[model samples]
Each structure stands twice: as C-alpha cells, then as structure tokens.
Target: MTEQGGTCAIPGDHHDTAACEHISRMLARISDKWTLLVVRTLGNGPRRFNALRREVGEISQKMLASTLRDLEENGFVSRTVTPVTPPQVEYALTPLGKEFLCPVRGLAEWVVANAERIDAARASYAERRAGE
Candidate 1:
C-alpha cells in the first residue's frame, strides 16, 4: 500500500488511488448523521417531503430540504414532481442509493453488535481519565 494525500492507497492497481479518493468522498457525503438517517428512511420507498420530515424525526425542515437537494445532486436519490394544481414532490432512492444499503446496514449491525463493548471501553477511558 502507498500513502497519497494522507490516505492509504493500494498499489499495483491502476485505478486504486482514484478509486480510494472517490470512495473517501462518497463516504464523507453519506456517513453524516442526517444523511445516513435520510438514506435509511428512503430505503423503505419513495416518500413525499412532509412524510420524510415526519419519519426522519427532529430534522429541521431547512436541513431536510438541503439534504434531499444534495442527495439528488449526488445521484443517490431522485426527485419527481407530480404535475397538478399543487405540484407534489417525492423522493426515492435511485439504483445507486439502493446499492448503498448493504454497507449502511452493515454499519448499523456493527453498532448493535458492539454496543456493550463500546460502552465498556468508554467507561474504562473515563476511569483512566479520572485517575490521570
């Protein structure tokens, strides 16, 4: 492995460096608290604006709107508008977004499986800090 831009880049593969950079950027975008929650919520199916707001609980209207816009720009979600007297907007995971679920769910499962160990580690750190 070679290090580039402070990232461990795999060697001997022509695309490895570029691929690592792309994956790093994608993870930065999707791993945010709100983004992950939004992605997971949309995994259920397409949802209207207000419905998404309600389901993603505690997200401000402003933040939700911004998140959806970003996701749409990234090709992870699609925004559809229904032509009616009152235009209706719905958001759904695109195929790319759907493929992202595997890793996201893996993260969720990891958190669940390690909760106790994490808590214990935190407690040990606290005890050490207290002694220090």
Candidate 2:
C-alpha cells in the first residue's frame, strides 16, 4: 500500500489514487447495514417511505431518511414525487444501483455458502482464545 493524497492506495494498480479513494468511500456507503438492507428492499420495486421502513425493519426514521438521501445524492437511488392528494413520494434503484445488486447478491450467496465453515472457525478460535 502507498499513501497518495492522504488515502492508502494499492501501488501498481490500474486505478489512480483518486479513483481508489472514490471506490473506498462508495464501498463504505453501500456496505453500511442500513444501506444494504434498503437497497435490497428497493430491489424488489419502488416503495413509499412507510412501506420501505416497515420492510427494512428496526431502522429509525432519521437513519432511513439519511440513508435514502445519501443513496439519492450518490445517484444509486432515485426519488420521485407525484402531485397527488398528499403528494406521494417513492424511492427506487437507478441503473447503477441495479448493477450494484450483482455484487451484493454474490456476497450474500458467498456468506450463505460459508456460514457453517465460518461458524466452526469462530468456535475453534474462541476455544483457543479461552485456553490462552
């Protein structure tokens, strides 16, 4: 690793230091628990705020709003408003966000496949630590 523009970047990689930083920041955002859940929930289809909240579960209103705002600002999600009685608002994934789901789903599948091995490894590690 090399320090470039105060961010740690891999040397000799195709990506420039700025590109590495951008990727790191985006990874942090999408890898967030709420962000992942929200994105997965939105993957099904567009949803109203309350419906999204209900589906996401255990997320506070403020956190969900903040996550949606960040996703929107980052162009991963789109917000639409209809001029109805109460002006219905909906949130859905953009093309980029839809593309992102590929890796996310892959990661989820990897976790499911490795869960038993992971649990056994963790148990062994805990046993060794306790003996220490």
Q: Judged by TM-score, which candidate is best?
A: 2
**What overall lDDT goes with each candidate model?**
0.89, 0.89
Give model 1's TM-score versus the native structure: 0.86
Give candidate 1's error at residue 125 in angstroms.
0.9
Model 1 poorest 10 in a row by lDDT: 6-15
lDDT of 1: 0.89
Candidate 2 local lDDT, residue 96: 91
* TM-score for each of the candidates: 0.86, 0.87
All predictions: root-mean-square deviation over Cα?
2.6, 2.9
62-93 per-residue lDDT for model 1 (tens digits): 99999999899999999999999799999999
Q: Compared with the true structure, what per-residue lDDT tens digits does model 2 show for residues 1-132? A: 455554445555644767887878878888998998898889899999999999999999999999999999999899999999999999999999899878878887899999999999999999999999
lDDT of 1 at 43: 92
